[model samples]
Target chain A: MDFTYDDEQEALRDAVRGLVGKAYHDYEQRRQAVKEDPGFSEQQWARLAEMGVLGLPFAEEDGGVGAGPTEIGIVCQELGRTIAPEPFLASVVLAGGLVSAAGTPEQRAEVLGALAAGERLLAFAHDEPGRRWGASAEQVTASADGDSWSLTGVKEPVPHGARADLLVVSAALPEGGTGLFLVQPDADGVTREGYATYDGGRAAKVAFDGAAATPLGEAGLDVTASIATVQDITRVMAGNQALGAMQTLLKATTDYLKTRKQFGVTLNTFQALNFRAADMYTSLELTHSLVAWATMVIAAGDPDEVAEAAARASLQVSRGGRHVGQEAIQLHGGIAMTAEYSVGMFVAHLTALDHLLGDGNHQVRVLSTKVADYDALDPLDV
Target chain B: MIEGRELTKEQIVEAQQTLNAAGLAVPHWPEEYGGRGWTDLQRHIWLEELQRAGVPTPLAFNASMIGPVIAHFGTEEQKKEFLPKTANLDIWWSQGFSEPDAGSDLASLRTTAVKDGDDWVVNGQKAWTTLGQFGDWIFTLVRTDPDVKKQAGISMLLIDMTSPGLEVRPVQLIDGSYEVNEVWFDDVRVPADNLVGELNGGWTIAKFLLGNERVGVAPVGSTKRILARAKDLAKETSDGEGGTLLDDPLVRARIVELENELLALELTALRVVAHSADGEPHPASSVLKLKGTELQQAVSELMVDLAGPASVASGAGDASDLAEWARISTPTYLNLRKASIYGGSNEIQRQIISRTILGL
Candidate 1:
């Protein structure tokens, strides 16, 4: 009911923003400079890990912050705003969450400490090359020969898969079901062809080819709940990031409009451009509230509510993401279309968030199916 | 075309019992007077859930326009006499503000009432009275003074629809529906106690009621249903080209644009509803009504366009390429032609925004 962010969450977000603020100025330039190896600075990663951010969602026994999704959302959103070339989303958020959710004590001892101490990075090697983004895992295998098991398939487009120290891979079983297996990145027969992801986070076309792997977590496990949790967290954090970048873009555009004179008047003084800015500003305002609501829904831990809220949040964000980026470029005129301008950077981040997981269309389809169910159940004409 | 209209007697009874059961029948009434004693959000949720459920739009006469006006501005005996029946729908009410001459400029209404005795005998015609033929009563504005400017002299009254010499006749429209009527009060007798608020202050009550009628009139769910139908028609209709009518670049663009607006309007409505507890008549109603009406009209137009030659085919909406699909769209479009005009024209909304929001 209380839609406003609390003091603790706000201060935590401000701290992350401060750190990222100092680290990035020309995000596009930094994005262009980064190669396929390490995405963000190791020193920065160490600073974040040392600040107890990477450990924010883990239990006290796991050498972590013991905070909830709100704190993680802070870091995720801040990183997204800068479009910081980093594995934070991959290592700190997704992989870290999965491991914390299902990993054994021995596994947590090895991975969580390395992650909390900034010694290791992990990737959730779940999404495949051709499937629509869902929890139907078809990436690897788990063959338990009495005592030992190993994985035997490819996990492509694994975010930072080449550089991640650990991989939590989801695989369909030979018998009938799905289980998440943990694999060390340097395992034998694990061949990863690396590439620089467009958003500047590293990804790879990985070929497992019967790689040696360690079995993790219990069997007959439903990762559906966990995967949805991850996606919702990802979505809200992505929205937060988009919020920051959009606000920055808005501020920059507002400033530009005030000073950039045309036809003997400033750009904003013109009705056509003014109306466009007003519309973008309206979208941003709505997206801001919807994202906040999504955070509340995710924090509440109801899957259907999370999906509906996230779908709605994505709908608003999808529109805002495109509108703000495009209008920023449109308002900035030719300089915006050029790579040299900040507007293009916002455009890059926006486009990335737009298509990430599945765009507005995918979420809307999910939402509409449920909405139809709701219609059928209640038969409310509305 | 719309087939026919029928008085929803069962619907009226159901709405009353349901509201009473939910304890939502009373809001502004005192607890001693049977009010819900609920918060603003609770009141809003009640309204929203009812609308979303499509039980029936709460009779504006009983719930919004008259009952609250009476509760706020009526005397105790007046309250004791009217509030209970209004709540129970013992007396169905109709609005008697709009005239044959005045629509949005309600204050300029030429209907005049002169004081004669312990009662006021009224002589005036009220046009576009929705369900007026079925109404048991009405609340009207009559010009009480002539020298004063247009808005100053109007007085509000509760006039019996069945009063002697009152005439109610239907105005058959192009949509083939008789939901509205022109009510003529031929020297009708109404008690002096029927006067609400002060003598010549009906303008305030009319404004209040108009504001009440418009708060969330966007009808998002119904529009969602309509747009869904349009999407189907667009996909189905053949444009006599290599593809369907949907493949027409302009048609697709329009659909996308309208859908985007619907999304925007929805978010806007959510924000308004979310913060609706702040004790204000939200300024965004101007935005919502503006966008909602425009989008509703656009959807109707899109339906007609997608129906194409079937829109004017040999058997439009009858055993043709369109079937019953075109019937709903045609009447719906004709009926929606008033959306922009009724809840204050979208142009009026723009003026409101220009003055209030934009500071123009």
Candidate 2:
């Protein structure tokens, strides 16, 4: 019932904000970091690990701090506020989340221990070239060769795929449903074509031609549901990240409106533009409410509820991100169109996040199918 | 009963007795004045539950608007004379803020009240006096001084609707309903004690009442109910192709979008209510009035669209075989247009958000 964060949560927010803000507070720092190959600061990633952020959502026995969803949300939001090019969402929340959710105790101990210590980077290679965002992997297939499993197929747009030391791949099992498997990027018969995405983030088209792999958990079992659930959780975190970016875009836009002038007056003198900024604020606030609620839903840890909440949050974030991102650039005029400014970069990151998991139309379809099952959605009922 | 527009005197009295006996009639007012001492969240839950159960809300003028003003600024004599009747609906109250010239710019109201010894002679007219036909009394904003600024010269007065030279003429709406009226005051006299607050202080009280009005005007619960009903209607109505209207992708998509928007609005309300402490309004309270009214109007529009051709039967009687819901869809859509118009129009809400919230 309470929306205000507790003292400890507030402290966590301040700590994360200080670290990310210190590193990427200046737009040039972020641009410089994304200009190169890995697309982020390795030193900053290690610092986050040192700060125990990468381990926020895992159990202590699994080499994580075992913090709750709200804490992870805090980190994601801070990262988003700066549009930090770090692969936290790609590596820690999504990839590390898949390993934690479907990995065996041994796998978790080995993989997460290294991940939390910043000794290794991980990427979840679930998206394929032809497949629209779906839980079950189709183009990627895994087969058993005696006691070892080998994966064959292509996973395109695998975020941080080439840079990741370890890959958590989703492949269709020979016996039945989709399963998670661990693969090495440098393994024989595996090739990665890494490129820069429009958002200044890194992605790779990974071709697995009978690449040696190990089952994430029990072999030949359907982890489709688990993958879907983890994706849902990731979707909620993505919402938090989008909220952070939108907040910054809105602030920057408003600040620009106050100071930026044309024809002897500041931009705020125009009611049309200021009104658009007001609408952006409205959209941000509504999205903020839903994102916060979805984080709590994840904290409650119910798969069905989490799935629905993630879709709702995704839908709102998708809509809000567009409104805020587009208007942010429009309100700032030519400066926003320049590569030197930060507003356009925020919009690019927002666009990337909007489609990372699922867009608004995707979410609407998901929700529409189940719209008949309930008369109303009561967030408090969760 | 669900409409709040169709409550009989007996039903209202019974509800007053039942709700007052349970101390639920006016849960947001001061405890000394029959409030239940509930938190803002609790009061929200109380009202939401009432709406969800198809129960008519306690009259807004009594439960939300003037009652709180009285509790905050009323003299002890005023409290003793008015609080109980206000809570129990023994005296129905109507709002008299908007004038023909002062719709959104309410402070520009020309209604004047001049002092004549122990009496204040009131003159001028008030427009859009909602539910004034059933009002036993009306709370008004009258111009008490001519020399000062428009806002500072105003005062709030409680006037008996039965007073001499007071006239209430029903104003027919586009929907053919008479839910609002124009009240003309011709030298009406009010006792000096009838003033709710200090002279030239009515603007502050009006602001307070309007803030309360915005918070309650969302009607999230009732809108949720109507949307749920729309889903049922969508299922029952056929699309002329063997499949139901719900089978149409576009129809279902629109419903889903509306539902999601309502969800966002409702959650924002909860967030605002949770953070609104010590009777101070949340900064995001403006969002509630702006988005809440839009969604409410959207749901009404959805019903009209769902009714399709059947919507034209808005005035049909029992002789027509069309479902009651279908017959009333268009009128409800027309009636709900007032949601964004009254209670501080949406444009004013945007202005507040831009100026006060965003510093635009």
Candidate 3:
């Protein structure tokens, strides 16, 4: 029932804020980091690992700090505030989460251990060329030969795929249902073509031509449900990240309104623009509330409920992100249109996050199907 | 027994007495002042349960607005004289804050109360006095010192509606209802003892009262009730294709989006309530008013849209064989436009967010 973070959570927030904020406080630092290949700072990722953030969501035995969703959400939000291009969500939450969710004890130990130590980077290659944010893989199919497995298909726009040392790939199985497999980027018959995304991040079109693969957990078993659940969890985490970026956009926009002058006075003098900024603040606050609530739903640990909560949160974040993002740039006038300023970058990241899991319309379609199933939605009841 | 209509004064009084007997009338006040000493969450639950049970709430001028002000700033005599009666609706109160020129800028109100011996002669007009016909007394803000700043010269006074030289004239609205009125005072005399707080301190009291007004104005539970009922109504209304309106994809999508937004608003209300402790209001309270009113208006608009052609027959009597809900839909929607307009218009709420919250 309490929304205020406890002292320890507050400390985690301050620690993350200090690290990420220090690295990305100046916009040029993020610009410079994203200007080259890999799209983020390797040293910054190692520092986050040293700070134990990479291990926040895993069990101690599995080489994680075993922190709750709220703590993990804190890290996401702090990273989002700076729009830090660290691939934390892509590597730690998405890829590492898939392994933690469907991986065997041995896999969890080997993968998460290396991940937490910053010794390796992993990316979730679930998104294929034709598939649109679905949990199951259609184009990619896995084949088994005695005690070995190989994957053949193409997964386009795999976030950080080229940079990742390991790839957690979802593929259609011969027996039935979707199964998860692990593949190395440099495995034989695997090719990765890296490119820059609009949001100052890296993605790759990975072609797997009979690439060697190992089953993430049980062989030939359907991990579709597990994949969906992990995606749901990642969706909630993405919401937290969006909240962080929106907060910064609002702060930066408001600051610009106060300082940036036009004609005879500062921008804040115009009621029309201030009113628009006010709407942005409202959007941010509403998104923030839902994000916090959805994170707690994840902390509650019910898979179906987590999925629904994630959709609800994603819907809000999608809508709010657009309202805040577009208005942020529009209110700031020409400066926001350029790469030298931070507001436009925030909008780009928001646009990216909006579609990363599911956009507002997509989430709405998901929710609309079950609209009549409940008499009313009561968040506290659960 | 009735669900969703204005209650007669007797019904309201009886309901108030029933709630007061159970100590549920004013749970947010101090226990010494007839409160239940409930937490904010409990108070929220109380309101939600009341709405779900189809019970008309206790008079807001008493339970929410004036009751708290009296408890916080009233003399012991004022508390003793007002709290018990206010809780039981023995004294139905009406608000007299808005004037023709002072709707949003209320401090600029020209209502004058001149000191004349032990009585204050009041002269001015108040606009948009809601439910004043049922009010036994009116709480007013009057200018006592014209020489000082407009806000600094004001005072709050409790005036007996039966006083001499007072008039109440109903103002017809777009909905063709007389729910609000204009009350004029022609040198109406009031005993100086009726002043609620310090002279020239009414501005602070007005702000406090308005803050309370904004917090409760969300009507989340009531909106949820209406939305749920809308779903049922959608199921009953035919869509010309031999199927119910709810069968349409667009209809269902609209309902789902509204439901989700309402859910978000309700959760935001809960978050605001949970954080508003130790007497400091949460900054998000402004969002509650802004989005709360928007959602309220949205649901009402949806109801009208659902009504479609039947909405034009809003004035149809029961004999028309038209569904009562469809008949009332348009008026309800028109009436709800005031929800955003009153309670410190949504635009004012945005101003609060920008200046107070965003420091813009």
Interface C-alpha root-mean-square deviation, candidates in order:
6.3, 1.0, 0.9
lDDT of 3 by residue, A137-164 (tens): 9899999999899999999889999999
When sorted by lDDT, best at the front, the candidate numbers are 3, 2, 1
Mark the regions of model 3 whose C-alpha exceeds 4 Å error after superposition: B1-3
Give me the displacement of residue A16 in model 3, in angstroms: 1.1
Which stretches in model 2 have alpha-carbon errors above 4 Å?
B2-5, B8-10
**TM-score of every model?**
0.71, 0.98, 0.98
Model 2, residue pairs in steric clash: none
Report the error of model 2 at residue A277, Å.
1.8
Tens-place lDDT digits, model 2, residues B25-70: 8887878788867777788877788878887778788888888899
Residue B101 miss distance in model 2 (angstroms): 1.1
Candidate 1 lDDT tens digits, A1-382: 4544689989988888888777776655455546436766777788888777878877778878788666776777787667666667667777887788778887776788789888888888887777787765765666766656777877777877888878888877667567777887788878888786555556787778777666667654646667776776777777777777787786677678778988898775666665565555556666766676677667777776666666667777887788888888888898887656667867887787766666776765555443312211111111
Which lDDT tens digits does candidate 1 get at residues B1-360?
Answer: 012123376676577757766767666455665676555445555665665454565576787778878877889998899888887777888888789899877777887788888888888889999888779888889988888987889999888877897899999877777888999888888889889999988888777767655445676655655675566666766778778766665665566555545755665666665565544655554567777788888888887777665556423533554556654556667887988987677666656654455432
| CAPRI-style grade of the A/B interface in model 2 | medium
- The candidate that wins on lDDT is 3
TM-score chain B for all models. 0.84, 0.96, 0.97
Candidate structures ordered by DockQ, highest first: 3, 2, 1
Model 3, total clashes = 0
Clashes of 1: 1
